[model samples]
Structures are given as structure tokens and as C-alpha cells.
Target: MKIIAAKKILKANDQLAEENRAGFNAAGVYCVNVVGSPGAGKTTLLEALFTALKDRLRPAVIEGDIAGSIDAARIEKLGVPVVQINTQGACHLDANMIAAAAADFDLAAIDLLVIENIGNLVCTAGFDLGEHLRIVVLSTAEGDDKAAKYPAIFQGSQALFITKADLLPHLNFNAERITADFKRLAPQSEILQVAAIQGDGIPPAADWLAGKCAATLR
Candidate 1:
């Protein structure tokens, strides 16, 4: 009975996701869903990304969190359009929530819409929020074995970002091993090492996003 109920919920969510996707397509807005655990530097990466791509793209953000709006506040300081979605106790952002928050944005004015999913690896992997791409962030401080343990998030993502490269020297993380594991699990996904704070590797990441935005607009 529980399994059946879960299926019904996911089915409904998927239908709504399709509707959201169609709406985004009509507006020519390229959206990316960014997922990661807490303290994975998802917001920091966005800060860097926005700074790097500011002139090239008119980007907006839908910040998701369980309670606070701190992430949204940070993005707002960057002078970009941002909407905060406090999920209260929800573990992940679903299509219905996205659909609601998206109404607040003038989608036609935005070239890219980035939905920063609530910080959870497991639950977020089970839900689709109608995004053109899914990027997962794994910080070195989180350890390299996360990819093997949280296979769903890594496997489903279109790109994997290894954040906090600046801390690599102090930590014992094996970048090569982590990259190998990611490649093994998500064979087609692009992998990039980024230190969002120091601005290392921001250009390629920005370039990749720019390419996607151009492709979507085309």
C-alpha cells in the first residue's frame, strides 16, 4: 500500500514537471537544477557563476531551503532576480513547488533559471523539477566516497562539480579517484573541479552553462 501511494505521488509530480518544462520551453528559458548536501558550496558556486556570466546571460534563481532564506539573501546582494522558497520541512523541491515559485518570475526576461534544490542528496534525486540540466556538487570536505554511497545523485546528474579545490592541499582527498568513480557511475556526465571562492575553474563552468543557454535559445 505504501509503495502504491508513493507511485501515485511521483506520477502526479511527473505530470506537473512536464507542464513546467513546456512552459519554460515556450518562454525560451534554460533552467538548471543544482543539488548537493548542506555546506557543499552550492550557493557560493552560484555567486561565482553569476559574477562570471552576468553580462552574458540574464539569470535568475529559485532558492530552496528547509527553513531559512540566507541563500536567497546572498544571491539578491549580487543584484540578480531571486526568489526564495522555504520548504518548511520538505526534504526536496518538487515540480509543484517549482511551478508555484516560477510564477513570480518574468520568465521571458530571464535567459537562465537556476533552481538551487534543498540540501539533500537522496530525496532530491527521486524528484525532477523540470530542468534542462542537473548539476551535482560534491565538496572535497565531504569525502570522496560520497559518489559510491549516494549513487543516485551522481548517476542522474548531467554534470558533477568537485567544489572547494582550494582546500585540496590540506585534505587527503584523491581527486583522481573521485573523478574515476564519477566517470564510472555517470559515464556521460561532464566533471569539473572548482574552487568557487578563489575563482579557479569558474570560466569553464560558466562556458559550459553559456553553451547550454545558447543551445536552448537556438
Candidate 2:
């Protein structure tokens, strides 16, 4: 019975995701769904990325958390449009939730819309939120074996961001091991090392996002 209920939920989600995709296609907005574990610096990376590209891209953020407005508050301070979705206890953000919140934004005016999913490595992987791209963040403090242990999230993502590189010297995290594990799970996904707090290794990410945005326009 549990399996059946889950499938029904996912089916409904996929249908709404298609509807959301149509809306994005009509508005010509590039949307990215960013997922990661709790306290993995998802908000920090987004704040830095948005600050770097805000002038050029007209970016907006949709923050998904279980019950707090913390991430939303951070993005709102950046002088951009932001919507906070408190799942009320849901571990992930589904398509219906995103579509409903999206109505609050002026999608046509926005060049990029980023949906920061509830910080969970497992459940978020199964739901499609109608994003143009899926970016997964893994922090060095979270251990390097995450890709192997949680293959579905890594495999399903288009890009993988290894955050907190500044702490590499003190942690047991091995960059090579993470790379190798990602190679096995998601060979084609671009992997970038980022230190979101110190503002290191972000230009490349911004450039990559810019390229994707331009491609979408073309």
C-alpha cells in the first residue's frame, strides 16, 4: 500500500511538472533545481551565485525548506524576488508546490529561476520539478563517499558542485574518490569545486550558468 501511494504521488507530480515545463517554455525562463543535504551550504552557494550574476541575468530564487524562512530571508536581502515554500514536513519539493509558488513571480521578466530544494539527498532525487537543469551540491564535510552511497541523486543531476573546498585540508574528504565515484554514477555531469563563503571557484559556475542561459535563448 505504501508503494502504491508513493507511485500515485509521483505520477501526479510528473503531470504537474509537465505543466510547469510548458509555462517555463512559454515564458522563456531558464529554471534550475538545486538539491543537497541539510547544512551543505546550498543557500550560501545560491547567494554567491546570484550576487555574481544578478546584474547580467536578472535571477530569482525559490527557497524550499521544511519549516523555516531562513534561506528565503537571505535571498530576499539580495534585492531580488524570492518565494519561500515551507513543505510543513515534506522532505522534498514536488512539481505542484513549485507551480503554485511560481504564480507569484513575474516569470517573463526573469532570465533565471532557481529552486533550492529541501536539503535531502535521497527523496528529492525522485521528483521532477520541471527545471531546465538539476544541480546537486555535496559539501566536503559530508564525506566523499556520498556519490557511491547515494547514487540516485548524483546520477540524476546534470551538474555536481563539491562545496566547502576551503576545508579540504582538515577533513577526510578525498576529491579524487568523489570524482571517481561520480564518474561511475554520472560520467557526463560537470563537477565543480566551490567555496561559497570565501567566493572562490564561483566564476566558472557563473560562466557555465551564463552559457546555459544563452543557449536557452538561442
Candidate 3:
């Protein structure tokens, strides 16, 4: 039945994910899988984060979208290596897609490989891309109940970034409530509130990423 078929698919994905992890280790690169909903500012955040971490780490991006290369174009304008993976109709990017896209880059020259997953919360959580870390982004405009409604993504992530902090004054977002919910679901994960567009909270985020990358690379 459907359950049996789904298990087979996931099993295949996990096997390839392990292979991808080995490749990352051999290349000495730290990879992060970034997931969020559309308009969650995933690309905008990366645009700024790349600038902040550029001098410290050679970072590259693998931009995934249901279609179009708009996000890839933005990253390329930053003078960094970027690969675009158009899933065509797929909801999430799988390990095989990552392996193919990653092969296009000279991984040895990169210190960080950030795969910006298709703007989504549900499917991406279950599919492992063999990333060293997983980050879930929630925009203040998206409301605070996301953690309660979609615990899988929130629970599985190593970090939660509540983006668009600049809008907090205007929106009736319950910051305290979201914080409590996130802590309950993912007590060990770090939560960072950042206005990625203006770079208000990017430095600390950059520092955290740099430290994680350094430790793994060493």
C-alpha cells in the first residue's frame, strides 16, 4: 500500500544522504539545509548572511525552487558560486538532486554550502539532504502558531530563525508565545530573531554559523 511505498522511497533517500554526507566530509565543507515557507525571506536573509560571512568563509548556495532561477540569479550577483535546482513539480529537493547540483561546484574551494530548500515546511522536514545542520525560518508576518501547527519542521530543525523582526512593532505577533512553543518543541535548538533585510541580527547569526563550520571543518 501507500505506506509501504513511502518507506521504500525514504529508505532510498537515506542511503543517498549518507553518501552525500561522506562527500561533504571529503571536501571539508559544512553544509546547511535551510527550509521555510514562501516569502519567508530565505533568499533575502542569505543575501545578507553571505556578505557577513564572506570574509570569514567561502560560502556557496544551492537555490531550490519549484521552477525558475530567480533566487540563483540573486546569489550570483553577489559574486559567489550558486547552483539552481528546479524541482519542476516536486515539492521538496531530495538527496539525489543535491548530489547532482553539488557536483557542479568545486566543493574544495567552499567552506560552507547552503542549500536553500523549496519554500515549504512539511515535506522538506522528512527528506534528509545530508546537511550538517537544519534551520527553519519563520517570518514575524507568518504568525506565531506555526510551531504548534507544524511541529515536525520545528522539532527537527537545529535552529529556528524568526525573520522580519522589523515588522514586530506593527504586527500583533505573540513573540513570547512563539518562543515558549519553540522551546517546548525544540529545547536544544537556538532561536534567533533577525531582521535579515536591514542586517539587524545577522552578525550573531553569522558568528554562530562560522563557529559551527569551523568546528566541523577542523
Candidate 4:
């Protein structure tokens, strides 16, 4: 009975996701869902990305959090269109929430829409939030065993960003081993080693996103 109920819920979510996808497609917007554990630097990556891609892409952001609007405030200061969705206590955002939050944005004016999922690596992996691509962020500070331990998000994502590269010298992280595990688990996904603070890997990440946006939106 529990399994059946779960399937029903997922089916309903999938239908809403399709509707959200259609809406994004109609507006020619390329949407990417960004997911990661808490303090994994998802917003910091976006801060750099928004600056890097500003000239080439007219971007908007949907920030999802369990409580505050801190990330939304940061994005708004960048002069980009942004909306915050507070799930109250939910661990992840669903298609329905996205559909509701999206109503506030002028979709026609944006080329890329970034949905920053709640700061969780587990529950967020199970929900499809109507995005063209899924990018997962992992910080070296979180330990190198995450790709092997929490394989679901890495397996489902289109790309993985290993953040905090600048701190690698101070930490005991083995980048090669983690890279191997990620490749073994998510062979098709692209990988980027980023230090968001210094903006080390932002260019390649931005270029990859620009390519995807062109292919989908153009």
C-alpha cells in the first residue's frame, strides 16, 4: 500500500513537471535544476555564473529553501530577476511549487532559468522539478566519499561540480579518487572542478551551460 501511494504521488508530480516543461519550452527558456547538500556552494556558483553569463544570457533564478530568502536577496542584488520559494519544512521542491513561483517572472524576457533546489542531496534527487538539465554540486569539505555514498544525485545529474578546489591543499580530499568514482557511477555526466570564491572553473561551466542553452533554446 505504501509503495502504491508513493507511485501515485510521483505520477502526479510528473504530470505537473511536463506542464512546467511545456511552459518553459513555449517561452524558449533553458532551465537548469541545481541541487546539492547544505553549504555546498550552489548559490556561490550561481553568483559567479550570473556574472559570467550576464552578457550572453538573460537569466532568471528561482531560489528554494526550507525557510529564509537569503539566497534570493543575494541574487536580486545582481540585478537579475529572482523569486524565492519557502517550502516551510519540505526537504525538496516539487513541480507544483515551481509552477506557482514561475508566475511572477516575465518568462518571455529570459533565456535561461535556474532553479536552485533546497540544500539537500537526497530527497531533491527523487523529485523532478521540470528542468532541462540537472547540475549537482559537491564541496571538498564534505569529504570525498559522497559520490560513492550518495550515488542517486550523481547518477541522475547531467553535470557535477566539485567545488572548493582552492581548499584542496588544506583538506585531505583525493580529487582523483572522487573523479574516478563519479565517472564510474555517472559516466555520461560532465565534471567540473570549481573554486567559486576565486572563480577558477566558472568559465568552463558557463560555456557548457551556454552551449546547452543554445541547443535547447535556439
Q: Candidate 1 regions off by >4 Å?
A: 1-9
TM per candidate comes to: 0.95, 0.94, 0.95, 0.94
Per-residue lDDT of candidate 3, residues 1-218 (tens digit) = 34444356578899999899999999999999999999999999899899998789999999999999999999999999999999898999999999999999998899999999999989998999999999999999999999999999999898999999999999999999988998999899898889998899999999988999999879
lDDT against the true structure, each candidate: 0.93, 0.91, 0.93, 0.92
- Greater lDDT among 1 and 4 belongs to 1
Q: Candidate 4, residues 23-107: lDDT per residue as tens digits?
A: 9999999999999999999999999999999899999999999999999999999999999999999999999999998999999
Candidate 2 Cα deviation (angstroms), residue 167: 0.5
* Model 2: residues with Cα > 4 Å off, grouped in runs: 1-9
Residue 117 alpha-carbon offset, candidate 4, angstroms: 0.7
Q: Write the per-residue lDDT of candidate 2 for residues 1-218, one digit (tens) a residue.
A: 34444356468888999899889888988899999999889999998898889778998888998998988998999998999999899899999999999999998789899999999999999999999899999999999999999999999998889999999999999999989988888877889999988999998889999999889866
What's the lDDT for candidate 3?
0.93
lDDT of 1 by residue, 40-63 (tens): 999999999999998999999999
Model 4 whole-model lDDT (C-alpha atoms): 0.92
